[model samples]
Target: MNTVTRPRILVVGAGFAGVECVRRLERKLSPDEADVTLVTPFAYQLYLPLLPQVASGVLTPQSIAVSLRRSKKYRTRIIPGGAIGVDLKSKVCVIRTITDQIVNEPYDYIVLAPGSITRTFDIPGLTDHAFGMKTLAEAAYIRDHVISQLDLADASQDPVERASRLQFVVVGGGYAGTETAACLQRLTHAAVKRYPRLDPGLIKWHLIDIAPKLMPELGEKLGSSAQEILRRRGIEISLGVSIAKAGPEEVTFTDGRVIPTRTLIWTAGVVASPLIATLGAETVKGRLAVAPEMNLPGNDGVFALGDSAAVPDLAKGDGAMCPPTAQHALRQGRHVADNVIASLRGGPMRPYVHKDLGLVVDLGGTDAVSKPLGIELRGVPAQAVARGYHWSALRTNVAKTRVMTNWLLNAVAGDDFVRTGFQARKAARLKDFEYTDAYLTPEQVRAHVEGTARQE
Candidate 1:
């Protein structure tokens, strides 16, 4: 008797794009038709937009981490690892497991959605001194680090040291940077009341960005409104400026202004994951170039989307590419899945096109700015919209409930501002949070796979 084998579909990264793609594939295809597998370090889809709230103690990390195993409808086998390299010619992906073991995964169809890493420049001391806000660990570390700084400032007698410890600088005026500064500033404001010896005025937050305006996507009026809110909260907003040098004790801005600070949060931008380079394909601005249908050219059964793919923007036309946002990633993921199914079924593939639904910027507390569906909103109304959007986007009912419960608890009860002692054991540096050196070269990937084959 002859046996049949199902076509194996491998999707990398458990982010917004990868998760959506897998879910769509599970619904659209049968077990006999295809077998899906996802390669990710974690088993949850992190709701990244609300990471600021987690850092500020408004929400727990578990609330934002939507579990992949929670859904009974999901049938994809979850591989607990990060894909470090991919061989387009061999149809194999190289993954580094959480235990640091290297393994090779083969697939008939491949979807590359490994997302992105924090973008850093060669500024002196930047990697060693600055903190990042890209992952759950980083957010938790930042919270603990911020609280520890307050504790140290209260205990220190030296005015210089206390001042330096209390001053916090956050670079970039985009959504991540702006929300991080706002949420953390609120945490310090509420936490200082616990320390009677520390002066309340000593806690200074400086938000700087090279961009001329704050959240330019929010438009001029809304952007200015956000800037005013931050300023009203006593946050020093420095536009048209960026860090020239970073040190353990202080940071010097491009405007030649040196500010003493122990905490420096870098959220400027993100670049495509290093895994994209292993494919040896054409890229636009570090992102893998892909068709409107999100497939690699001349590479059958290979697709890329989300932050790692420069998918063309069909809505705008004129050769414009889609911006790296959650909205686009989610849509692209579904579209890619449909296209993959079409490839298998021998159906015509459709191009992806979706209009912008507008932007939302949550500035902590009751302050927010939003342009949902082309309608401008600000203050409490905008805050409601921002939170509403996040609440609805959460993948699971448990996530939504937990997030709602956290918001309620935070509203009535204040944050304890307790330090978890993570920073005391080791400083939270950029390199410490992001494993930038974990990727493998193409030669190494091929050699490892060949070696594994020989062993088997």
Candidate 2:
């Protein structure tokens, strides 16, 4: 082993931003310059954009999850755990490893790309009921739960229980909610063919949002087109309505309507990870406020980006911050890497600038809408653009091949509609996946680091 010491660089989270940063750092930085260490709960950088397809059985979970250890020359030290807290003054990160052991990691330079978690309101019984689509496991679990619901409903004799099992409700009108509702609806639509007893008519899907327009960012014409398509497919598209309360077997809407449903998918939106709050830094709407260069003001060695950082959108101007999208996060990662390297070499840093690439919504099968380069498209043309974008975005040849093969197989042979007993529960809430409550307070972080120091 080389005896010469180098500056220790630590990166948290393996999402788009963190992964891209690490990859760029590895390629750009020589071994003598800096040592990069990545902290994450998973070994793979999940392609989160295709999560809905995984939930709907269009693509296998492994297809989107690209492994980080793809090269034998990989030198970055990997910590398979989550950073519960960060002490900026001490330059140490408190981590909870996969085995539930707590440890302290000191760094010369640290990147905070912990990303976002599901945004849940104080609505009654939300924690007891509602499912999420933020993680791979959540997506897989949802697939199993939906399949199980169909099985249970088909095997039931009681009309009430069967009816309740057949109804599904999805909350949120953004890309996640719309795509999830659309993909899962198609899953059930194709699945009912396997069930002889369950009438396809009995299966109902309700996609509602508190926002007046569905996918408002897509502009009025495309938004209306998407709504019309969903409505024509027997899905009840309700705007300006939301869940008043969620229960084990029902969801009460804000409009005084009570619908019985065993499945409640809450994709309302996401908030910055509570991990960012451990720094006790200034934040804008729960996201860490960073300068245009994606660094904390006054904290020279620390940087934040992705969903957790409120990066100023210099390209958009007028005091607008970049939206928490994969597009922005991926680009920010590369830019932040350049900035970090610049800081290390005493070079000047440049602000992040990205041109709008537009949006794509794959509403299952040939029905879709997209705005690439400000030009609107619909039907097969839009679907082509959507899939093509996702396919091109895959990080590895193996991942791309797996995804393409899975897509082809799914298109030709179709899904078996099977459920893995991975999640052995009737209902799982958002709390089960993301450990938001597990984040340590600032005082605790200081104590933990000090305690670890004394022990060392």
Candidate 3:
């Protein structure tokens, strides 16, 4: 039997939660005491709050993807893999490596922070026809898709198809949906000036939501102001409605309004990664339930945080769970780290409690809406505050510099709207993202075993 001397801590993500756990472990433990490992598909911590900017071409995609390995070399071993499942009874995790290999790793302690995937609904033709604005790839694809639509419209002779191609519809009124519509519209406005043949008046952006107000989190006054600004920009805001159906050439809304368009960006919201539900533990709103200590109930050395775990917001009464936001995720990550360190040293675990900081909505261009530290601001000052917050929130200096440089260049030279046309063929397929399942089918596994037996 192989004897292990050092304590092993396996973290199942590189996002706010996992990263925070690793950082704390490194700071608290000496090199001789423990080893920290982070398992994530990508080597970067995605700054999700600014993902809409990437989609809208306000900032390049790389600006938001801070390199995980580079930032945490002193703390943990970064494994490039997607965690598939956990054997909580054995403290083992099954991870699928980027190279398509699955391996089980044992650990003394575990932290689950797998984050989330787009929360999709059962609307007809939605998954097959709509574009998503969740990840880095999705943002890049959206930029290309938008530019390509403009290109196709500019070259097309059919007025109806051109109009259809020019029309862009975004579902959801949360930060993601609202910012996506705002930024993309700004992009189209800037780009159409370079396209002489295309009439800018023909291009339209529609923001739809089932909620009564756009950016309802911003309070009624600020939300109304934002809605008015978007409306002034020639964007349509539809409330109390959602996309009923999406097709290759058209979309039908719940309000019985049909619009012909090739673009439908779905940013309704996010749900915890399905892996959390598979843990067989109590969950709140589909997230793994965690104690105030950030530890799994009745399980020693196991913890969860971030979007994947439904940690209580004691700050809010009546058993409220923390909203899945980057700010909360970040604080939870740090708190979880502290709790883990306390557990290791036989110290008391502290309850996590953080007051709500203000939210920022970057509307692209020189317009923004923000409430920083409970102070509200709009227009260019709000835009500056929004961008400033994102800049300061980034993990590393390099990320900050890169994002600033991109902003400077964008302001000076304007948008490039250059379509890469890479993901065009793979567009319109959820299966292409490898989201449903990552493992081989039973038949395929059996066939593989048979082939191996014959070879032997």
Which candidate tops lDDT?
2
Write the residue-wise lDDT of candidate 1 on 42-100 in tens digits.
99999999999989989998999999988786789999989999888889999899999
**Which segments of model 2 are wrong by more than 4 Å?**
1-4, 423-427
- Give the least accurate 10-residue stretch of model 2, judged by summed lDDT: 422-431
Q: List candidate 1 stretches off by more than 4 Å.
A: 1-4, 450-456
Q: What is the TM-score of candidate 2?
A: 0.98
lDDT of 3: 0.84
Tell me how far the alpha carbon of residue 408 in candidate 1 is from the true structure, in angstroms, after superposition.
Answer: 1.3
Quantify how close model 3 is to the true structure by its C-alpha RMSD in Å. 3.8
Candidate 1: residue 252 lDDT (0-100): 95
Candidate 1 to native Cα RMSD, angstroms: 1.5
Q: lDDT scores for all predictions? A: 0.92, 0.93, 0.84
The lDDT of model 1 is 0.92
> In candidate 1, what residue range of length 10 has the lowest lDDT sum?
1-10
- Distance from true position, residue 431, model 2, in Å? 1.5
**Shift in Å, residue 20, candidate 1:** 0.6
Backbone clashes for every candidate come to 0, 0, 0
- Candidate 3 residue pairs that clash: none
Using TM-score as the measure, which candidate wins? 2
